[model samples]
Target: MSVINYGQLLQLAWPEIILTVAALIALAADLLFFRQSALRTRFLVAASIASIGCIAAIFKLLPGSSEGMLLGGVFLSNPATHLVQIALLVIAILTLFLSVDSTFTDHVGEFVLLILLATTGMMFLVASQDLLVIFISLELLSLSVYILAGFDKRSSRSAEAALKYFLFGGMSAAFMLFGFSLLYGFSNSTNLVQIASAIHAVPLNPLVILAIVTTVIGFGFKIAAAPFHFWAPDVYQGAPTPSAAFIASGSKVASFFIFFQVLVIGFAGAEGSATLHHFQSGWVPVIVTVAVASMLLGNLVAITQTSLRRLLAYSAVAHAGYMLLAYVAHSEQSLAALLYYVATYALATLGIFGILTVTEKQLGNDKISDLAGLSRRAPFLSACLFIFVLSLAGIPPLSGFFAKFLLFTAVLAVSPGSKLLIGLIIFAIGMSAVSLYYYLRVLKSAFVADPPADATPIQSPMLLQLVVGLLAAGVVALGCAPDLILNQILKVIHASGL
Candidate 1:
């Protein structure tokens, strides 16, 4: 925390700094140079700049480094953190590419700028261990996304989605902030490690219990867990497609990672237990209840959805539940498994939305039936959709399949004798089966059903198709070779002791 160490703050935060610079540059370029250009031209230029900035930040993270924590953990850099940040940037860059063809808003520069700003927030959110920094980063990301959701000013649905997102997000922030205040009051420190040390001395006091519930409630909303997921279906259906994609992909990665950190590191000794017939009073049980509710509700409701976006939104809630299983298990391996599951999940959802962007434009709606005979109209995209959905459904030799496999394996490894753990895993597996039915329903529309008599062939932008193709290939590559990313994640976790 010395002055010279403060000097290293810039070095530690170079990725976020680069992203901010990129955002400003994009804004300026759009205002000064492309003010009257065609909308496509503006989007092309802005996306190129934004993509370069993301690539630069990724390169900055490429070199190996010993872990560093500066500014009393307000800034942190390590291999594990870098990996997650890289994943976030990748998702952002893909989203940027996906947006190039969108006509939702003519403010091309502003759109790109907000994407970069949101990426910057996610980078900081995943890297920092300080509660204050985390809160600021969350708000930064949230505010940008709220605006982006309502970016299509011409649409009443867009405006409504943005309002609901903002209101719920504000309430969640307040809850999280109050929880942080309680933690700070108890520990007299804003640092997570310090807070953990303090709490270890008086594990699960009434105040700490309050803090845990409030904090979980706050994060639950972010991850779109059940009972707090009122905004997701609307946002998914109403927001600009690219905005929805970013919210589902990059934000999920950063939020879940930090949530894990707060619980496993900051609330270490208060895990209690979620074992069946041996339930304990702690955060674990709270997580277990949310997970169970999310799994059941998300899957069942998705079965009734006709709209693709709402179906995916409900599916996202179910996926959130599955990812929370990692929290319940709370093991080193579970962390790795969670990252893999969430990362692959993000890629799959991004591709789905990318396709939806094109299909919705071509068909004038995003209903499942609207995609009828997609295999005939846009064979390549239909194929990609097949891959993305099956991956999400956890089909074999696909990344989603492996992600669930590893996650379930990790949870079972912890207290295999615990009936509660076994039952939860069984329930998760059953829900995965239920998820397959709905996902297959999508495929049936695209492949098995016939299109309307007046239907025309769908034509998507080359850039959009390229982005979606890459996402699909990524899903396939990661699934066929699970170790490609998982090994690196494990190595980083082991090295960083995270």
Candidate 2:
């Protein structure tokens, strides 16, 4: 066993420590100094502090930060993990920016504190290579998010969402813990590499298969994949906009990153083929099955939704399916593809939710019809929405398009002439087309439909508008220059020898 190095661990964990300090400071400032301040003023101060802390964390991770393992592999630091941690911080910052004008909760300090805490959990989550660390980090993250979901105490829907999320999360955690215990019993180690070595040496057994299934169940709920995704639509619709945004963005990056690691690293030799008619009994086949269900159910059901958040929830499920395709490939290129796709997809989804935050505040609803004549009332926001929605629908010259292209190409590259994968790609393409219909319904409401006679222009805060615009611009820039982010991801993957 490796000796625990307290000093080295602290050196590697400075970024998370910074964020925790910032969370406490934000909470204290809100309770003591800003309790009587205006909601907007309180939000501004807390958000500024949080943003600055996130910036500090990002700087800590810049190019030359320490990289090593600690606590017998309970903690890990590597270029790839640092890259993901940076992305999580960036998403948290953006979520904070979008929350500055929120009125759902007056407890600005607590809200921001929870966000920071959740982000800290995510940072720890992506930096670990041990099952014990992973489970603990996930619980920390999940607890914080459950509170955030119901932060709007005035709304019963918010409370209900929180209750449902907590219940489902508890069950998933139990399942994941059981799976981890089985893995520990099998390998006598919590370290993923050692677990992989053990798995490689033994024949695939019933207990190993059970562990894989239970582990998948746990992560499936996290990523909002179908069958295990019953909690997502409600949570997305009932939770406060900022909470949903964080769940969809930062939480997703962390969850998917760890999921990839657990499968590709911990279950290395057990990846049975997922190719059509050639399916082997491994994690890949399980993921492929989930992917198919998510794509079909998410797209087909989204077409019937009128609520914008619900539609996006279903869309997220579908996008999760697309993202899962990378796992089917399970190569370094697939890792890069998955990261780029999830990052870009998260940006687009967050931008859409940001638009909802503004429009819902002004119009009093997030129904598709609430956006009627949005172009006439809020042209800039509408234009931003155009970019965001189109990007999400995988329209050309947008980040979503390139993300899908890279992912599909990577999967195809994995098996040069596999008919099953080809068919899956074709089905995914069809679902993308199906997705365009619902997305256009949103655009049609914003651009083509006539406004209510009493409608007035949406008066979004300038800062909020700017943040949303920046997010839309990011989607566009990434799409137009896919290599910009993809190259960075590839560099980290290579540097870590992933």
Candidate 3:
């Protein structure tokens, strides 16, 4: 066995280390201020410290040249991983921003600390190249999120969300662990690179197929894909809005990153090998079926939703389908598209949730109808909401449109002559069109519908407004000039030699 190199490992893992230290510091600060009368000030201090830590972590992550495998090849530092770490950190910072004056502000230090821990987990998760590392990192992320989901002790809905999430998440973890065990049984290894090499030498077996399907299903739950997405709407509706945003945006980015890594690396076989062909044949069909179901079901179900949070939850399911298109294609370009799409999706979704949080605070509910006459009362907020909603619907001149366009284009590029892929593209287009109706429904409530007699202007904190405005601008910028980010993603992919 190769000896571990401590110095190199530290360099590769600096971001995670910084984040962990930051979380501990935040926790200590929380304890220190537990009895303080200046509750809001304590929360602000914790948030500020966490934000500084996140910024520091980003800097640490940015210095690398996307080279090196650390800790005996269990962790990798590449351009793709760096980019994902940056996105996760940004999402954490945004979550911190939303936490101020929100539901969990009373427990702000714990909130910031949990976000930091989750961010740390995701950083490790995206960089992980071994099953053991993957499982541990995933748990770190999930456990933090579970607590954050139920942080509001006074709300039974929050408790229910946590319980359901925990139960479902536990089952998924079991399935994934069993599947990983199967993989180890076949390959005698947990390291993905070694597994790929080993699988190339082993005969394809029934257990291999089972492992692939089960593992995908496990990840399917993580990404909120259809048939495994039952836990999302309730959790999003019940959890504090910032927690929901973290789960939806930050968690998703990390999940997809790891999923892509596992698929592209672990089961990949030598060219022309039976194992490669068998793996693809076994997994692609399953992915395509899930994608089709997710798109159709998510879009169709979202139309009937009255609560804005639930609507976004279902919409997230559909977006997962769109991202799954990248897996089906399984090429470097497709992976780039996936990364680009999720980044844009996270921006819009987080912006929407931030606005929703403010609205919920002022109106005491997140019903779509509550946004009526928002244009008259808070034009800036309403307009920002309109932009985010339109982006989500894949409307022209918005980031979501370009995201879908790139995804579909990558799909077509991989198999231009395949009639089945063409049909899938068409179906995806139809679903996008269907999604517009619901998105527009919300926009109509915000912009066109008359306010009730008691309607009053929303008084969002300036920080919230700044956060949403920046996200809105990011959505528009990514829409209009996607290459600004896409170019960087392609560079990362190229550097990784994918």
Candidate 4:
């Protein structure tokens, strides 16, 4: 191992450091203002501090052009890392905005602080190149989320959600750690590059395949892929809306990026080698099966949900399947497609959840019927929600359509002649069509159904309206000119030397 220098490490890790400092400052402020009668003012102060930290981190990340290993190969910093960090921070800021003046106001400072810490962990997770670093960062992210999920101590459902998530997360961590140990035993190193080099020197073994399967299963749960996705709907339904949004967006994005790194870096072998063939053949079938199952099951089950949050939770599972299609293609192009699709999905999802937060606060429930006549009560909110839901359903002239197009195009480009791939593609298309039924069901409730006699117009805060408007505009912009983002994605891919 190379000796590490603290100064250089701090420079490479400036974003995480800034985030940590911000979290600490928020914690101190929370303690100082715990007895303040004006809860809103306290929350705003904390949020402002967190936002400043995020801005500072973004500035630190934007200027760097160097790309190389950091801290003796435990972490990496490249264009891809920078992009993921920026996404995590942006999502964190949005989440903080959503929490303000909402149910989380009672503990707003802690809430924002936890989100900052979780975002920092996500940034580290994406940059990690060592098994130990990945595990530590994942734990940091997961622990903060577990608390955030149950932050509404007054709600039984929230408590139940946190408990279930904790249990499942613990199990997944064990599986992943064991898998990492197995890999280390084989390679005598925790670094991904070294593992790949070591694996290429030996014949394929059952243990190696087992490690791959175990690790993928662990990651499968994180991304809410099928068969391992039973916890998602329950958690999403019960958690605070902003917490659910963060889990669905920031956490999912980081998980997929790290999973991609583990597969492409740790298992890859020399060109034309038996080990490379073995790794590909071993994992491709597993991912394909997971993707197909996630799409079919998630979409089919979502149609029956009357609760808006549960319905979106199942929709998320289906989206996970769509993102996995990129991995099935297993190329740099596919990775770019996955990133673009997730970024678009995150924007739409956060917008919808932001609207839900306001609606839930006004009405005290998230039932599908609760959205009835939303257009009459809050036309702008209704319009934003419509755009987001339509985009999620992959309707034309929206970001979701282009995202799905890129994913399918990437996969088909690689495996055009494979009968299995063709069948899976058709199945995915059918499932996407099925998904439209449920998405439109929500829209119909919002736009066409009658409002209750007691219903009153919604009065959302200006900040939330601004956030939703920006996200909705983003979806439209991406749909109209996907190349704007795709070109940047291409640049990142090239910069990474992949």
Candidate 5:
């Protein structure tokens, strides 16, 4: 192992330091200008803008750089780190836009600060090569989210959701830590690189199996993967809409990065050196089982939901399942496609939820039945909703379709003979069909039903209207020209060597 170095640590932590400083400066401004809500709101918006600007700065700063492990191997600066940070930045920008007219009014400054902190933790998690770093970053992200979930302390439901989520999240975190302990015992190393080398240098033991199995369960809960996804629906339904959007997009992306990094990078053969490389077939069943059940449970349960928020919660779970199939393919095409899918999904989901938050404030309920005949009442909002739902359904000529199509084609190229692969593909096709029923159901209600005699016209903000416009255009643009994104994703895949 290389001796400890201070310079590399600074380089690795610069981005995170920038974000931390911004949050402190913004919070100080909030405290200094104590009595004026208008001034506070304006400054809060400015702080969010500055935070996003710093994210852009980091993007420009880190793309081609390589600073090895930092914080004694806790944080890192590498090409893959840059990719995950970019995704987090996108989600942060979306959250800022959504917060403008939402219920984050009373504590906007604090909320914005916490959002930046949550993102900072996520960045650390993606680059962490040590168990200590992973555990710290995980708790950092989770604590911020728990408070965000219960931000509306006045509401019992929100408080209840936060408590329940915290309990489950904390328990899973403990499990992960315990597994890491077992791994450390087996390998005599806490660093991922060292642990991997040790794994092959010695024999696999009971502690090794326990470490891998238990850690998967821990991360599965974090990503809301099947069997570990029980907390999602309730927490999502209870959190403030913008908070829900943040968790749905940011947490999922960040956690998935760490997940893939663990399986693909840590488990991969060493740099330019040959060993018994993985066959990958062993991972297929675990992923396939999660994918099938997530699709069946998330989609089927969503069909019975009257609450739009609850429906979206399940829909996100189903999407996770779909994305997992691409991972199972274990090819460059699939990896590239997964990144594109994540980017497009983040933008589309944030835009859709932005509108939902706006309309909920104007109409006060997120019930699908309450939204009956919304087309006549608010044509533009209804149209935007239709586009998003269509995209979610993987309808042709939308980004979602390309995302699913590329995944299927990639899987076919790699494992054409396996019955498991065949079954998964068929299940994907069937689930797509099953998904259409629920997706189009919302559209049919919007366009075909009659507006209530006493229904009121929804007044949405211009900013939200613009977000929807961009998302709708993006869905069509990405779908028609996936090659535009394919190149960027290809860079990411090659760099990660996944």
Candidate 6:
């Protein structure tokens, strides 16, 4: 034996450790360097450098060593971890942009700490191979997000959002804990792989089904899938735009990854045949209903909204529906579609929200009509925003179209007998078509309408704009190079067998 040691675990978690250490370094740098508000641009540059360095640590895992690579079996660095970590890194960069103009310079160091802490929690959450560890990591992320969401303590809505989030989030967590207890009882194991094997070995009973349902609902709350989604709009509207962006991108995406991990690795092994044979019928309907509801609610409610920020809030909820289209699919094809969709969605959403935060400052709280004829004032800025909106609307050649198409095609492939799939496909197509109306409404206001006589087109910082460029390019590139992106998803899927 080559003396199994702690060093292996540390190596596995090097990226997360690097990020945490960087955050502390940034904090000390802020304290030491500041005679006045650390020069915004200079401080931001440093922070960006540190954040990128943190993400670079993730690159080490891309070559993926999967022989129980971390924590002597307590942790893992399998292909699933690789793909999810990549997603997490991309979202972290987006958060950097989202906060660049918000509080990065003034309270410069503190926001970075919060972001890193939250992200660290996410890293642990995804890497965890046991339910107990996953729960602990989840709380770490949740507590950090709860605070961040209400960082603007002066705002009543921010406070209210935090409270509402806590209540609902807490309730869901309780259900999750209870479900975990039931699962531990039934399967006699907390280790995800073993529990999954146990569940798969036996027919899924009422208790097992309850455990699964409650667990889904718990994660559902995190992801803003409907019924559990009531908190998202209020929270998004109330939270600082940057925090909202992180919450929207990082929190949901991380939860999605964990939800996926817990299910696939916990209960979806080969023995999963027995469990899946029973649960698929039950869960599919519920997922479809939530998905359809989210789409309609998001798009329909968004039309009447006057504020651009609020509209985007609803738009995020609707987009949640689109993302869920991948999950409702009970097959690997749908999952690969999901992987592609989320990757595209992550970059595009981050870019759009990053721009939103910047412009909100200049335009003074984005109202739809206020955006009248934006192209005339800042054609470039308007064009960038247009690209984002078009992507959101699923216009072809943009990443959004490809993501939607992949999801639809995947779902369609699984549609042979399930009437639910047929109905879902129709709903998905109709919803896609219906979304054009609201997205176009924004576009028309941008290009066709007249600019506000007083307001000028806002200019974005070069780095932030560069980030936007990267995301826009990513959106298109993902569409054009579907196989490349899909391949990573497939490998992860194969490893996890989701």
All candidates: TM-score: 0.98, 0.98, 0.96, 0.95, 0.91, 0.90
After TM-score superposition, the amount by which residue 378's alpha carbon in candidate 2 deviates from its true location, in angstroms, is 0.5
Tens digit per residue, CA lDDT, model 1, 356-469: 889988788898988889999999999999999999999989999999999999999988887888899999999999998999999999999998898888999998999999
CA lDDT of each candidate? 0.92, 0.92, 0.86, 0.86, 0.75, 0.74
1 against 3, candidate with superior lDDT: 1
Which ranges in model 3 have alpha carbons more than 4 Å from their true place? 33-37, 63-66, 200-203, 270-280
For model 5, give the 10-residue run with minimal summed lDDT. Answer: 267-276
- Which whole-number lDDT from 0 to 100 does residue 290 have in model 6? 72
Predicted candidate 5 versus true structure: per-residue lDDT over 400-496, tens digit per residue: 8888888788777776776666778888788889888878877877888887898878787787687678778887899899888778778866765
**Which residue pairs in candidate 1 collide?**
276-420
Candidate 3, residue 493: CA error in Å? 1.0
Weakest 10 consecutive residues of candidate 6 by summed lDDT: 269-278
Q: What does each candidate score in C-alpha RMSD?
A: 1.3, 1.1, 2.5, 2.5, 3.8, 3.4
Count of backbone clashes, every candidate in sequence: 1, 0, 0, 0, 0, 2
What number of backbone clashes does candidate 6 have, counting pairs of residues 3 or more apart or in separate chains? 2
The per-residue C-alpha lDDT of model 4 at residue 228 equals 86
5 against 6, candidate with superior TM-score: 5
Q: Which window of ten consecutive residues has the lowest lDDT sum in model 4?
A: 270-279
Distance from true location, Cα of 212 in model 3, Å: 0.5
Output the lDDT of residue 116, model 2.
Answer: 98
Residues 1-498, candidate 4: write the lDDT tens digits.
578876777778878999999998987887775546477667777888898999888888783644567754687788888988888899888888777767554877778889998998899999888999999999999999999899888889999999999999999999999889999998899998888877764445778778878888899989999988878988999998889999989999899988988887787752221122344445666787788889988999999999999998899989998888777677888888899999999999999999998999898899999899999999999999999999999998999999998888888888687666577778888999999999999999999999999999999999889989999999999999999889888788878865
Which tens-of-lDDT digit does each residue in 136-212 have in candidate 2?
99999999999999999999989999999999999999999999999999899999989988876435788898999
Q: Which ten residues in a row have the lowest lDDT in candidate 3?
A: 270-279
lDDT of 4 at 196: 86
